[model samples]
Target: MAKEFTSLGLRLHADAPHISYVFIKHHKPKEGEAEVPNALYVAGLPLGLDEVSLEAVFSVFGHVANVVLHPSKRSAAVVYESKEDVSQALQHASSGQVVDFPLPAPEGPVGLKAWVASHRAQRPGNAELQKQLDGWMEAHEAAEAAREAARQAAMAEDGWTVVVRSKGRKRAREVGGMSTVSGGIAPAAAAAARAAADAKQAKQAENFYRFQQRDRRRSELMDLRHKFEEGRKRLAALKAARHFRPN
Candidate 1:
């Protein structure tokens, strides 16, 4: 830790009251991340403020990748395109201040009681979250490999190369927005539904053609019956008169 200094009008944690300033260690790049100094964590944002507008103002300093707001923690994290971008942003800030972020949607230059942290401190439990994600990805890849191997074995003894997934195509989705294998309907159920739909359409087409053919035959029989009725009426009239003429 450097000289015990206090940040003026900045708070790292929301739970701690009465302590307006915090003594944070010098920023070291987060472990396991890329060598590029690409992220900046901002603290002391107001509740309910959106990340989009926060990013919009910070964009003036550098090309921003994403801005994630932690409403529960009352902090936000901004990722830049490159390490140089981070340095440029720090230069834009006032002397001794890490982040010069203005309060989101302020009338004048009057800003919030905010401070920026390293990528690590900006988010709590990020390490554990990353570990879980990595484990999930590994399991997903292993399962896919097993399926491919089984498919190859099923292919009759004729030598055939197993085709792998195409590049750039995503394999599995995470649990947030889309309903994945955990929360979504099973694959077997989906396949059965598709088969049922196909069968119903086929049945409908068969009935439609059958009805059309029946209608044609019925019309032919109706025309013959109508002609017979007319001939019978003519014969009756001729017999009643006791004479028959071409008229």
Candidate 2:
């Protein structure tokens, strides 16, 4: 059977963190009904987690209905069949421990559908919006560059020294140590390393900034395309209704 969203009593608030109240109704087997109960609602969790681990942890209490992970938000939704199962799951669902990440605690009942809708509605679509996104991306890139420079400078100041392991040996085995360079690092090597570090940082920043820009553009284009399609469908429906009107 298809999953029902209405079964979860989800209350959506504009200014607060999303939350939802889930209530599962128990019913006896009529005739050849499945022994396990069906899950009514699921809560979304933060991203970067292994599905197998979550399943293993939650399954200890009751059967898991669905666990949907969102890539962008880095969150997931886990649905349980019975209220008793939910209670059990809640006991083990400690933030940043069981899942190896901090889970956002919802204030009250929340609807995932509504939250998605709100994000869609608030998304930028126009040329001005694109310009703003580009500006933000550029600013982020610049800030990242400054941070990289600072990190490299700090590393250079706190030089890496080579320490000999033994006193008598044909070739001494040098171990890495963080000690001040008496004569300072070779100017050429230090400059080259700094340049290399800067180049690497710039490349990484550019790649990340470009990726974000591409995703934003793609989302905007898709939203516009969907809206256009909906308008066309509405127009076609109106035309068909008018043509088929009884005289």
Best by lDDT: 1
What is residue 176's positional error in candidate 1, in angstroms?
Answer: 56
Tell me the TM-score of model 1.
0.28
Maximum-TM-score candidate: 1
Q: Please give the clash total of every predicted structure, in order.
A: 0, 13
lDDT of 1 by residue, 129-175 (tens): 89989999999999998996576565523544333343343345432
lDDT of each: 0.58, 0.54
Among all windows of ten consecutive residues in candidate 1, which has the lowest summed lDDT? 174-183
What is residue 9's positional error in candidate 1, in angstroms?
9.5
Cα lDDT, model 1, residue 134: 100
Candidate 2 per-residue lDDT, tens place, 89-192, comes to: 44443221222222344543345655776676798568869899899999999999889667655775677343323323224332233342223456677789
Q: How far is candidate 2 from the true structure (C-alpha RMSD, Å)?
A: 32.4
Give the residue spans of candidate 1 off by over 4 A: 1-36, 71-73, 96-247
For model 2 the local lDDT of residue 24 reads: 25
